[model samples]
Target: MKTDRRSVIIGSALAGVALFAGGTLSAIMDVADARADPSPEALAQAGPLGDVVLGSDQAPVTIVEYASLTCPHCAAFATETFPQLKEKYIDTGKVKFIFREMPFDDLALAAAMVARCVPKDKFIPMVEMLFEQQKQWANQNARQELFNIAKLSGMTQTQFDECLKNEEIAKGLIDTSQRATKEFGVDSTPTFFVNGKILKGNRPLADFEALIKEAAPT
Candidate 1:
């Protein structure tokens, strides 16, 4: 808790620190290691990637999801289908879930990056909030909406902007989605890879259950 609180203070300072002149460069350097394509030296100092995993890693089923923060169908799945799936399979140690970003627009990418800026453990909850409130945000006032959502995790407006402005993270998201498109033919939101079988769009709970049952390790 102490560490997280301190991080909020430091992270908020990052937005305005560039105006300080004396500490601006040093502040940038401090988070430089967090850049997506950092050198090995920087990688050594890098923070958590916020790629949260649920259930045991050794679970029989592995579900990898590629979704966008601003996608309505993705939110539908999160709000409706996912809970049932999580309750029946994921929470029972039968499935290991991994979420990957596939942001389709500037606003989606910004939301994704803001989700990444928080403490790693808070990543999934932040994602849930964004998805649950997808209709409320994803507007002309998206930046403000995103800030309101991000503040639940202790992010200030300046920190929220700073997180979105990090090109490395933004580029990394683009690169990831592009790779998914070229290699895996992923061009939409709520694409799921259930033990290698690709299921696209918002699938109902029954569809996911059947898919999981078929793909789940015996």
Candidate 2:
């Protein structure tokens, strides 16, 4: 029987990624309304690795996004509407944005791991770069392609290798994903929780603007 290299690569890349430590995993599963809309506070709580947030914490509106790195819709939003959203809202201190990983596949998980390994300040830029060049690297050799991307942010080859093999980082991401799924009912990529209101999919800029306006207090 022939062995599938991709499977081996992904398996190796994601080894021990699914191990959720502590009682939080069980607590998340025990939530009475896994599908209920989460409170803004609950949604804003950072995962195991903590959150790399943008804008002021006291902003009038907070936008929490659960996205997969390899999801084209997520890529679209990252490369397209996010800039405008950042300039008009995030940068202006009207909206605080939080990006959470909810990877839907092994490749996305691998990409998320690499994104997490970058410097805190470089995280958003790395995410945007990965989304912009997603077509170029996502379907190619996982190690080489991801390493190429990782190097752009000053990560050495050794660092990249170590990142992929870091059980803690990988597990943190999986824990975050599970929490998003079970606690927040985030079933799709690019699901935005705008002030605790669930808004799914890659909507137009106008739609986001409208939602932000509605969420903003008078």
Candidate 3:
């Protein structure tokens, strides 16, 4: 599959690129350059989700993943590739994995919030569920589908409704994603930052294993 062309901004306000079926189009915006922070405070804030340390944090290899729950490719990666990666790298402590939200639509955003609503210990499982059931939810009516899935996670209708309507949480997620896009130049779902080097799209396990070996410390 042909991946979309991603535009990296070296200055202020990263522009959004539209992804079409066959190709992508982007318009570069000229603006005052924003100074890049060698270590962003956002990394610190990610701690609530889990341990996200700096400077070869956890291990020599670090994988920062950006994914959307509604994206088919994101679902594919989670289902087909994440388990092997987890067993080989994450579980062995050879790599530290960070999962970031990259919602492309309101449904995706809502699913992101749902994953966050669960306890930290359940976060990964909830996210996996979201991806595993993507087709079922994606094909159904948005509101009903979301509520039904939330039920699986033990969220009541009222609780799910409130969680979805929480503007503060929603804004926080959007801001985090915006920071990733503006700071790291991420433009698509399932973009992986393997120790700050960008790898975009869902690829086979062999491709990731090769990158992992290259990133891992000797």
Candidate 4:
């Protein structure tokens, strides 16, 4: 198998740093070479083209989130921090929020597919359900976990199976996600772009509050 390009470059840079400290020429050369290389397909899978729009197209602040359903950090953010932000900013018309799927594993991809099955109006709620039950679906050994979650979301078994088997939808999702990663340089889950400023990781409510305050209308 071909080694992932990003990993190779990253490993080379780290080894150079450790093995040649004193600002050596060889280390500098390695760093330069790594810089010339592009990231791998995995890193390039951030989102789709035209998927992100700044500010409600009207709101002062736009929050675009690239997240994985099975990621514990993402679940924590959704369950703990998002509600406050939604109430204080999104609901108040001060901010517009867009969620893009970033699948970290097969389970996460499955969850993303199920979330997309719901109508656009129920998209956020279905997303919340997936995050809220991440543990149940993520930990279960059976593939039926996805089906079970789908049923809870009002999908019959046949519908769930058909949706899961819909290769076109899956490919479209993957393509969109890839476009997002390539365009936005998204390397990790739960990455947020608030008014185009990147915020990585599962941050506390205070951080969001500060950004919202900064972006709030005068």
Measured by lDDT, the strongest candidate is 2
Q: What clash count goes with each model? A: 0, 0, 0, 7
| Winner of 1 and 3 under lDDT | 1
Instruction: Flag the better candidate by TM-score, 1 or 4.
Output: 1
Count steric clashes of candidate 4.
Answer: 7
Residue-wise C-alpha lDDT for candidate 4, range 1-218, written one tens digit per residue: 01133211111212212222323211111111211112333332344322432234467777778787777989999999999888877777788777777664445666676677766666677788878887887785435766676676678877766665555555556655455455555656688776666778899978876776776747
Worst 10 residues of 1 by lDDT: 26-35
lDDT of 4 at 8: 11
User: Lowest summed-lDDT stretch of 10 residues in model 3?
Assistant: 11-20
| Decoy 1 TM-score against native | 0.75
Q: What TM-scores do the predictions have?
A: 0.75, 0.84, 0.76, 0.73
Q: Give the number of the best model, judged by TM-score.
A: 2
Full-model lDDT for every candidate: 0.66, 0.76, 0.64, 0.61
| Tens-digit lDDT string for candidate 1 (1-218) | 01121111111222222322223221111111111221222212212343557888777777778788778889999999999989988999998887888765545666778888888888989999998888887765665677888899998877876775676676566656555554555656788877666677899877777877886635
How many clashes does the backbone of model 2 have? Answer: 0
Candidate 2 residue-wise lDDT at 121: 84
Clashing pairs in 1: none
Candidate 1 overall Cα lDDT vs. reference?
Answer: 0.66
